[model samples]
Target: MTASTAQDAVTAGFIVIGDEILSGRTKDTNTGFLADYLTAIGIDLSEVRVVPDETDRIVEAVNALRERYTYVFTSGGIGPTHDDITADSIAAAFGVTIDVDPRARAILEAHYPPGGLTAARLRMARIPAGADLIDNPVSKAPGFRIGNVHVMAGVPSIMQAMVDAIAPTLKTGRKMLSRHVDADIPESRLAERIGEIQAKFPETLIGSYPRTSDGRFTTQIVIRARDEDILEQATAAVQDAVSITLA
Candidate 1:
């Protein structure tokens, strides 16, 4: 699916692929990075799914997410190792053939020394048919974008670089605006009023984050909305709620 217009809300889904992530062997940081990146670029990250290296699971998540969101991004299964089955799974998800792309091979060749492009290294050149290459400046091994899905390396630096490469081509929407109101009280004291405010401002999202400092409890109310006026109103309401509760 293509990106929606500026007036429409463009949404995205993220798929984190790797068995290590599920086994607690690797901590995932890409999800938070991508969420921030997409939000900054005006694309709402609507969903995120962490799946193992199994081809079926990858294909299932890819197909489901691709059909649901404006764009789908996948990270962690496009490497040169045998466990890197993201390319094959993406091809299967789209019912297309996948083979070594000459352009990608040329890029890898230029990066590697003479005869350095071994069979394992060549695996990085295997891209799905009708996909466009996403440049990875960190390493020469490029990522590929097929339809609305972008497959990038599992490495954080490379994935971030790939995001930069594809950022310019993406269609962005109205940026979401947010305001934070801190209350020197616990969430339990403000929960009812915050819920009432949330119901009153249906167009805005109100979230309460609670924290403890020096044996004292406090809450941070974050109000998010596309409209500045609505955000300001909701933020003011939350502040008033906090003040009234404190008084």
Candidate 2:
């Protein structure tokens, strides 16, 4: 669904590309970081996708998500490795040629001289036309941005630094408000009561997270809303329904 670009709401989507991730060899860390960071900055993460390192797949995902969401962030497969085809796929998605962009080349040349610029390293400089370079503080090889997609390194630390660098450029909306209350109750017993409270507070979203560790059933009911008053009301209703005093 297309999210409203109103003054109070922001929407974002993420694209993760790599064969390692698709094959379950590498667990994704960027998505959780992006979700938490963007939520704190008032950008709702509407969708996330993980695709294999294939040109056609990447191009299709980029085109679809870029048009659907206000901002799109991609991680993985931008390195100097042989399977790193993110830049070319991104160029194809935007219907442009992959070339040694002067700005990108200048950025790289300052770090790696002509003789030092191997084919693998030069692969990082081949950005699409009219794209801006994203600063990667962890590595000399920079990520590039085109349209709504902000491409970054797959490594967690580097991706986080890139995110910090680009956050200021985005127009963030009002932050989404949230409240949570935990109780030592089972989900099967709490589900009906929680449903009742949710129906009463239509604007608030209620979620029940049940965890059974150490042979104890612990449940957490979280209330999420765009409005503070509604969140407060829903939280109170949940507490009342569950018969626990929330701290």
Candidate 3:
């Protein structure tokens, strides 16, 4: 995905790679962040998968997603420790050789002290063949981009930095718009009406989520679409139905 060209639609998938995430030892935040970010930029976050630190699993997941989506992002398992197998796994997926690139090594060398760039720390410099580095501003240890797959750090701060760095370079489509209307009634009261409204505007996605306020029952009807006219029509219909029920 390049910055110059706009597409009719753009789609993305995310792979959260870590054993700690599956083990419940670490909570996953990257998926939610990517979902919201992609939507804001007019890209559909169509799918997501979580895989462990195992190289084979990561390779399989990466290959599948990269082929399916316009872009695939993987977060986690790219650290200096022994278990950080993401780079190796991603390289294996692309049938590339993994080696410490001089550019990456230089960055790490500059970040650490004269003698602090140990063999373990140098592991962060490994890049798959023909891949470009994704700038990591928070920590100097950079992430990398291979083909349509971007490999990022697991830490939220570092990951966010990487995302910001790459956001401007991605192609985008028309942004999806959304709005919500509140009803002073339970979801059951609006259920049938919602079905009718949805049927009327099949192009728009309508959903009802019940909410409680000050001991009163209510439902929040959310309507989303790229077409503002259709969205407005659905919103008005929903409001009228709720008002009539109250009357």
The residue pairs that clash in candidate 2, if any, are none
Where model 3 places Cα greater than 4 Å from the true spot, the runs are: 1-7, 214-216
lDDT of 3: 0.90
Off by over 4 Å in 1: 1-7
Stretches > 4 Å off in candidate 2:
1-7, 244-247
Which lDDT values do the candidates have, in the order given?
0.93, 0.86, 0.90
Q: Which ten residues in a row have the lowest lDDT in candidate 1?
A: 1-10
State each candidate's clash count: 0, 0, 0
**Pairs of residues at least 3 apart in sequence or in different chains that clash in candidate 1:** none
Best of the candidates, lDDT: 1
lDDT of 2 by residue, 92-207 (tens): 99998888877777777889756888877888888888899999777767888899999988989999999999999998887888999888877777898898888887766789
lDDT of 3 by residue, 1-247 (tens): 2232224568889999888899999999989998999999999888999998898899999999999989999999889999999999999999999999999999999999899999999999999999999999999999999999999999998999999999988988777789899888899988998999998887677989998999988899999877778789988898898898889
The Cα error of candidate 2 at residue 8, in Å, is 2.4
